[model samples]
Target: MSAQDSVPTPAATAPIDPIPTTSTPDINAAPHDPEDPETGEIEDPDNESSRFYGPEPDSNPSDGDSALGDYRSTRSTSVSSYVYDYQYENGRRYHARRYSTEYDLPNDEKESDRLDLQHHLFLLTLSGALHRAPISKNVQEVLDVGTGTGIWAIDFADQYESSKVTGTDLSPIQPAFVPPNCQFYVDNMEEDWTFDHKFDYIHGRMIVVGMRNWERFFQQCYDNLHPGGWVEIQDLNFPLRCDDGTAGPESPPMTWSSLMIEGAAKLGVDLSASNRFRDIMSNVGFEEVTVEHHAWPINSWPKDQNEKEKGMWVLQNVLEGLQGFSMGYYTRGLRWRAEEVDVFLASVRERMKDKRSHVYLPIGVFYARKPMGI
Candidate 1:
C-alpha cells in the first residue's frame, strides 16, 4: 500500500456556481383564466404563484411556519452490544463504536427514515438515475462506503443485476433481506481494508462527517479499484449560502453550521470536505475528475416549480435531521449540555422555516476514474 505522505498536492478546482434563486411569487398576480383555443381546455393556473398561500390571520408568528403552506416549525450502549447494544444521548441513539469514534450521526429508526428520504431527494434531483458515472453495463464488483441503511447498495444491485454489491458500515442496521447479489459488512473504512478483490465502481455518499483521513480513504478507493475503474461521491457543502443577504454569517443557519464545523474539526472531521473532493481525488492520482453542483433551498423560497418542490423535501429532511446532527457535535465535541444544544437547535429550526431567510445548501457530486495504465 502507498503511504499517505506520498499523496501529491493538487491544483484548486472550480468554484461552486451559484444558481439564481427565484423571487417570491406575487400572490396578487392575475390568475390564469384563458382557455386553449384549439382544445377549448381551461389553462391551469401558475403553480409557482399559487404555491404559497401565506400565513393565516389567526396563526401566531411565534408558532413557526411550514415550508409547504401552513405555518409550523416543528444513542447508547455496550461493546458486545455493538450489534445489539447501543448508546443514547438526549433521547437519540448512536451506533456503538466498534473500531473508531469518527462518526457523529445516529443510526436509529428516525435517522434511517431521514437517510431514505435523502436518497429519494437525490433521485428526484437526478431524474431517477442511480449514478452519474458512465460505467459499462458489463461492469461488476461495486462497493459502497458508509452505506447507511444499505438503501443505495440495494437499489444499485437491483438495477445492475449482473453485478455484485458490497456495503460496509459500523452499524448492522441494514435489513437482512436484500438482493441475492448484495451483501453488507459491519466494518470501518478508516481501518485497513481487507477486501480480496478489486472493484469496477466505488461509491460514497453523505460520508463527509464519518471520515477522519479523506486522503487515505480516496487512496484506498484508488488502490481497491481495477486499473480502469470509477469512483463517485455526493455530499453537501457547509456554512449555508444565501444570495439575498437574508442569511448572513450571523444568521441562525450559518451560526449553527459554523458551530458544527468547529465542533467536527475538534474531533478531526471536516464538515466542509465536499468543497475539496475534486482536488483530493486528483492528488490521489485519479484521472478525468469532474464535479456537478445542485441547489438545495432551505425552504419553499424558490419560485421555480422544480426548485420549490426540491425545497419542500429538503426542508423536511433538514428539520428531521437537526437533532441527530447536533447531538454528537454539540454535546461530545463542543462540550455543551444536552439542554443547551436543544435550545440552540430550536432557534435554528424556526429560522430555517422562514422563506424570507432564503438560505440554501450547496450539493456537490464528484466523480473520477483510475488511469488505465496504472
Candidate 2:
C-alpha cells in the first residue's frame, strides 16, 4: 500500500461547528407566532382560541406534515451552550450555532457543573433515556436522538450492556473515549430518517428550540420505533413566570422568560412547547401517555444548603449552556443587545451559583408509550 494509504483515512467527514450569524431580525416575515413584545406588533397566534385535540396517529402517516404545529424558535447563542466543546473540543469547524435533532447531551456534568442530586437527576431520569417503560422490557434497540456529546447514550450504554446504543447529532462534538457499546453518528433528524432497525425506545430531550413540526417529528419517531415501543420527551414549558399572585405577566420575571421565548420562536424554536407535548404524542398513535412537571430553579434558593449547591451547579450550566442552548431564546426572543443579554445571563448565573441564594431548580418531562399489537 502507498504511504498515503498507510495513513488512515478519516472515518466520517466531520461537520463544521460554525456559530450561526442571523443578527438581522426578520420581523415582518418571521415564522414565529406572536409579536416581538417590544416591537409592539404581534404575529398571528396559532388560533390559540382553538384547543389542541390529540394528534391523530393512525389517520394518514403522511398527514403529520399538515397536522403537526409549528412552534420552533432559535435566536442568540453564546459560549456556555458550546462550552462542552472546550472540554471535548475536537472539530469546532462548524459554527452553524446549532445542529439538527438526533443529538445527545451527557449527564457528565463537571465538578464545577454539579447540580442537585434529587432534582436534576430526577429531571434526567424521567427523560425516557434512563427509565424503563412500563410496557416494554428495559429499553432495547435504543436511540438517543440529538445526543449532544453523547452523554445520555454513553450512560445508557453503561447501564444496558446488552442493548445497542446509538447517539446521533448534526455536529460531531461527541468525545473520543465513549463506551464500547455506545456509538455516535452525525445526522440531521429534521429531515427524513433512513434507519433500518426500529428502536424499542426513543428519547428526545430539550429539543424545544430549532424545531418546527411536532406532529411529524413524533410520527417519525413512532415509525422508527418497534411495535409497542415507548418514546419520551423532556422539555421546558414556557419559561416559568414567577407567580407571587401580584406579579402580572409583564412583570420582570415573566418578561425575562418571555423575551427569551419570543426570540427563539422567531428562529423556528418553540420555547413554550410543553403544553403541546401530550397532544403531539397522542397524534402519533401513542397510548397511555403521561406528562410530569419538575420545577428548575433559575437560581438556587431552596432553603436547603445541599439543594442550594445543586441549584448553583445548574445555574453554572445555565450560564455556560446558554451559549449552546437558550441564548438564542433570550437574544432573539427579547431582541436583547449583546451586552444586555450578557449582563442578564451573567447575573442569573451569579445568583444561581451564589452559595447563599438557596434556590431550587426545575424542568418538566413528558413521556408516552405506543400501544402493543399495532
Candidate 3:
C-alpha cells in the first residue's frame, strides 16, 4: 500500500456507552409543577423525559408488546456471483483480493442477501428516496463506492434514466441482469481512483468498516468529482445505544460492539469513523457539509407507526447480518476460535430477539459538495 493509503492509528477503543443513561420516566404519573411546595425535586435538563424524543408528546417508553413478531416475513432479494474465484474461511466466502488489507464481512450469497435487505431498510428509512441531495435531474454521471450488491446503483439508474451509474466493490457478487445505464466493477476505493471521466454525484453506504484512510478516501472523491458535484455517505455509528437502561453494559449488543470496535481498530480500520465524516469532508475542502442523525431501533419496541415498521426490518437485518459481520473480525483481529465465535454469536441472536430490550443503532448521513470554479 502507498503511504497515502496507510490507515491512521486509531485511539484506544473504549466501552460501548455512546448515550448516557437516565432514570426511566413514569408515563402515567401526574405532571409536577415547579411552584408546588409538595414536590421536592425539580427535573434537570438532562433528566427530562423528552431527552430522546425532542418536542414529541410524552408516551409510554416501554409500552410495546413484548412479542417479537415474525420479522422474516419481510421481502428479501437474492444475488449470484459473476466471478468464480473466492477465498473461504470459517465456512464463509471472502473476496479474492489477494491484498494485505482484509474486509470485515464475508462475500458469500448469504451476505449478498443481507446487503439487499439492508438496501431496502435504507429505502424504508428515507421513505423511498434514492438520495437526500438536491441534485438536478440532468445529472450526467454517478458513482457508488463500495456498492455491495449494486442494488442502490441499479435503482438510481432506473430512477434517473439520463444518468449513467457506476458501482465498484472488492467482490464481483453483483448480479448479471441490471439496468442498461448501470454497471459494476470489482475495485478498491482506497487505491487511486482511475475513472475516465469525473462524476456529477457520488454515494457510499455502510462502507466504514472496510475503509482505512477516510481523509484520503474523501480527497479522492473530491478529485474525481466535477466542480459543484455532490457526495453523500451513509453509515451507522458504532457501539449500540439505549435510551432506556434496559440494554445495559452486559447486553449482547454492547459486548459485540465493544469487541468489534477494538478488533477493527487493531486491523487498521476505524469502525467509529462514521461520526467524523462531516469534519473530515470540510477539512478536505468540501463546502456545505451537512449531517443528519438518525436511529434504527433493534426491534419493534417503538410506538410510532413508521418507526415500528422500521424496527421490524432493522431487527431482521441485524439478525441475518451478525455472523457475517463478526466471523472474519473475531478470528483475524481478535484471535478467537471458530467454535467460540459461534457460541458467542448464538447468545447475541437470542438477545436481539427480545423486543423489550430497547436497543438501537445510531446512523449518520453526511452530504457535501465540491466548490465551483476550482
Candidate 4:
C-alpha cells in the first residue's frame, strides 16, 4: 500500500450507533438516543431510536426484544403508507411489523447498519472502492445501491469534493444531513431506475437477499457506467465456517443459521452466493476483475488469542442483528409469535457469548472495471 493507500483497520470502523457529526448532523446522521453517553440518562434525544433493546413491548431492556420491532420496508408502490404482511413467498407465514417512517422510527436503521465491528469493517471495505478503482473528477455522478447508513457514499462525497453522490434505498432510513456533494433518493433498485447521468463508480453491499437478479443488477450497473466505470460488491456466505465441526448441528449458532438460510431461500434470495461474486461481474461484461476472500471466524474459532477476541465480537453482533434481519420478517412477515422469536434470539445470544466453540466465516469481495475504450 502506498502512503496514500489506507487499508481499513479495525479502529477506522464506524460504530453501530446512529451517525453523528462533530458540529452538526452529518448529511446522513442517525445516532441512537439510548443512555445518552453525554447525559447518562436512559431516554434523551440520543435515546430516541428506531432500533431498541427489549424482549417485548414494555418489557425489560435486557430481554433486548423490547428494543426491537418487525422488519421495516418502505416502498412507494404500496397503497398504504405502511402495510403489515404475515405471508412470505412459497406460502410461508411469519409475523411482520410494518410502520411508516412518517410515524415510526425514521432514518434510524443506521443503528442496524453500523451495528458492530464486522459491519463497520464492511463499510470500511466499501470505502476502499475509492482506492481500488479510479474514476474521473469529470465523472461527476456516483450511485451507492442499498446505501445502508449512507456511510460509504457520504465518505465518498467527502473525499471527492467535485463529484455528486446519490445513495438510493427502498427505505429512506439513511441519515438526513450529508455533505453538499451527496444526496439520497428512496427507490427499489430492483425496479427500473430513471436517472440521467451514467456513473463513475457503483457500489452494492450486504444486499444479497434484497437482490433477486444479480446478473441483471450487474448489467444495469454496466450500462449505467461511463465506459470505464467500476462496480464493487461485498457479501458473505451463511452456515458460516464450522471448520472443526465444533459448532455442531444442534448449536444455537447452527439453529440461527438454519432459520435464516431456510427462510431466505423460501423468499427466493440466495444468502450463500458469495462465490458467485466474480461470475456475476464477468457475466455483466466487466473486465479486469479481482476477488479478495477473507477469513472470518464466527464466535472466535481459533485458539489463537487475537482471532478469538475478534471472532467473539463478530458473533455478538450477529446474535443481536439476527432479530431485525429475520424475526422482524417472521413477526412482520410470517407472524410467528413474539415469544418464539424471542426465544430464538435468546438462544442466538447465548451461543454468541459461548466461548467453547470453533467457527469461521467466509466472505467475498469482488470488483470489476468496464473497458474504457471499446
Candidate 5:
C-alpha cells in the first residue's frame, strides 16, 4: 500500500502520558567533584561559593521585583483583539493574523488538531518531558511562546500546579477547558512583549517561522525571565537525512524539503535556524547552555523495535500533515499553483514509503539559563 494509504488516522483524543523523568539524567543537577568522581558530590572549585552560584534569592528579593517592573514597563500595551481572518487555498486555510504572511502555516481547526498531534509526537520523542531545562519545583511562573494549541502549557500547568502558565500564539484557537493555572493569549512573540510578571521558565517549540530576529527574540526571552530562569527551544531540522544514500539530492523528500525551505526564505523565515540556537542564546547573556539532538525516522525503517514504532508515528505525522505545511508556502512564497503543490507532495509521499530510504529529521533541543547578574 502507498504511504498515505498506510497512514494511521489519529484518534479524536490522544492521551498525553506524562513522560517519566527518572530515565533521563538531569543535566542541571549539581556537578560531581572533579577530584572525586565516585562520590558524585558537589565541591566548589573556587572558595567563593556565592560568586559562582549566585546570590541567594531571600538575600535580595527586592531586586527581582524591580527587574520585573522594568520589563513590564517596557512593553505594557493592552492585548490586541483575537482575529481569525483565515485565507483559503485549495481547501486548506492559513492564518490571517499578525505576522500572517511570515508564518506560512494554517491555523484552522484541522491544522490545530495536526499541531496537537505534532506536540504528542514531540513528547514521545523527548520521552515525555515538556523540556530539557532543569526547572525548579519552586518556579511560580512559566511562559510558552508559540504555543500552537496550548497543549504544552496545559500539560505544564497540570504538571506544576503552583506555577501560572501563559501560552501565547498568533491564533486564538486554543481549547476552552484549560487548567485553572493556565491561560491562553492571542499575541505574536516576534513583537515586543508586554508581560506584567517575569517567568521562571519560558518554553518555545517549532517557532522558527515566526521569528525573523533570533538575537532580538532571545534577548526578549532573557529580559522577561527572572534571574536564573530557564528557556528551552525545541525545533526540527529540515531537508531530511538518509544514512545509506537512498534518499539523496535527487530524492523526492529532499526536493520537497528544498522547495519548502526556498519558499520560506522568500518569506524571510529561516527554517534552518535551529542549528544556531546555541550561539544565539549565549550571545543573549544566557548561561550554562545545553543542546541535545534527537532523530525522528521518516518511516518504519529502523531495526530497533522502539525506533520502528516511533518512526511509524513520525511517518503518519508527516504524511497526514504535509499538505497543511506545504499549501501556503508553495502558493504564496513559491508562486506555485495549489494543484501543482499537491501533485509534488503526492510524489514525495510515495518516496517516503521506500524501505531503502533511511531518512530522519533532526530534532534539536536547546536549553539555557538567564544569568543571575549579567
Candidate 6:
C-alpha cells in the first residue's frame, strides 16, 4: 500500500488531548511571585539565586582546542539580543519571550554551545552531508525552522551562495556574524506564517519538542513551499533502545527515558512523533516521500570502526547535556525536586557509560516533495 493510503486524515478542528497532568507544577503555569523576603524562601520562578545547581562549568573554557583533542570546536561568538530575552526557572534558563511555552530546552550560552556540538555530531553521522533530502543545488530559497545558533543555516548559506537562507527560532541566541545570504528571525513557527515568499526548501532538525501539532506543522510546510519544493525533517525518537536486552526496563537510561517520555506526554509533547512523519507528510499532500533511519549508540559499543566513532560522539553529546536535558522536563513535567532529578541523572549517566548496556536511539529523517500541480 502507498503511504497515503495507510494513514487517516485528521480533522482540522480536532482538539488535541492535553498532556496528562501530575501533582507537580503545571508546565505552563505562570512564574511564582518573588521570594519571601523575611523567610528567604525562593518563590519566584525567575529567581536565579534559587537554582538547584550552578551552571555546568565548561571544561575547556577557551574556544580553541588541541588538534588531537576532542571534537573540532567551532569559532564561538556571543549570543545576540535579536533572539528572545532569557528567563530562568529552577535555575535553568529559557526563552523569556515566546508565543507559547512549547519549547522545553534551555536557551542560554551553555545550551547554544551544546547545540553547536550537536550540529557537528550530526555532520559526522551523515558523513558531512547537511541533509539526506535529494534537493537540487540550484534551489533559490530555503527556510530553516528552529535554527538554533544558526549554524546549520549559516553552513547552508555558505554552501549555496546563490540561495538565500532564513533561519528562525524563539530565542535570539544565534550569533550576529553570518553569511551575506543568511538572516535570522526570532519568530514562533506555530503561529500563522506571514512570509512574503514561499520557500523552495524547508528544513527542521530536532524540533519535535517545539511542536504541539505535527499534522498542522506538516500542513504549514506544505502551504509554505513552492511547487515541487522539498521539506526535510531530522529528529530522534525517544526511549533509548537496547538490542542486546542488557539495558532492560530496570536500567537507568531506560528508566530515565520512561520518566522523560511520561513528562513529555503530560506536556502534550510527542518525543516519538517523528515516527509518523512519512505518513503525515504523504497525507498532507506531499509526494515522493522518503524516510531514512539512523541509529545513534549511547556509548562506544559498536565493533565497526565508523559506527564506533559515531557512537563515541553520540556518547559525548549525551553525557555533556544529560543534566540540562533532564532538568526542565523532570522538574516541571514529573514534578520532581531539582536535587532528586540530579541524583537520578547521575545514575543514568553511569548506565549510559556501560558498554554492556548497548543502548542507542533511532534518528529519523523524512523528506518529501510538494506536488508540482499543488
Cα lDDT for residue 48, model 6? 21
Ranking by lDDT: 3, 1, 6, 5, 4, 2
Off by over 4 Å in 5: 1-83, 99-101
- Models 1 onward score TM values of 0.79, 0.64, 0.80, 0.67, 0.77, 0.80
Q: lDDT (0-100) at residue 101 of candidate 4?
A: 13
* Number of backbone collisions per candidate: 14, 51, 0, 42, 2, 3
In the range 84-153, model 4's lDDT, one tens digit per residue, is 3333422222223231211111123323333323344443223223334555666577888876556667
From the highest TM-score down, the ranking of the candidates is 3, 6, 1, 5, 4, 2
Q: Model 3 Cα displacement at 76 (Å)?
A: 11
* lDDT assessment of candidate 5: 0.66
In candidate 3, stretches whose alpha carbon ends up further than 4 angstroms from where it belongs are 1-84
Best by lDDT: 3
**Which pairs of residues have clashing backbones in candidate 6?**
19-266, 83-172, 84-172
| Overall lDDT per candidate, in order of appearance | 0.70, 0.49, 0.71, 0.53, 0.66, 0.69
Residue-by-residue lDDT tens digits, candidate 3, 215-287: 9999999998999999998887787777667778888878998998888888988888876676789899999
Pick out the ten consecutive residues of candidate 6 with the lowest summed lDDT: 1-10
- Tell me which of candidates 2 and 4 scores higher on lDDT: 4
Candidate 2 CA-lDDT value: 0.49
Candidate 1 lowest-lDDT run of ten? 5-14
2 or 6, which is superior by TM-score?
6
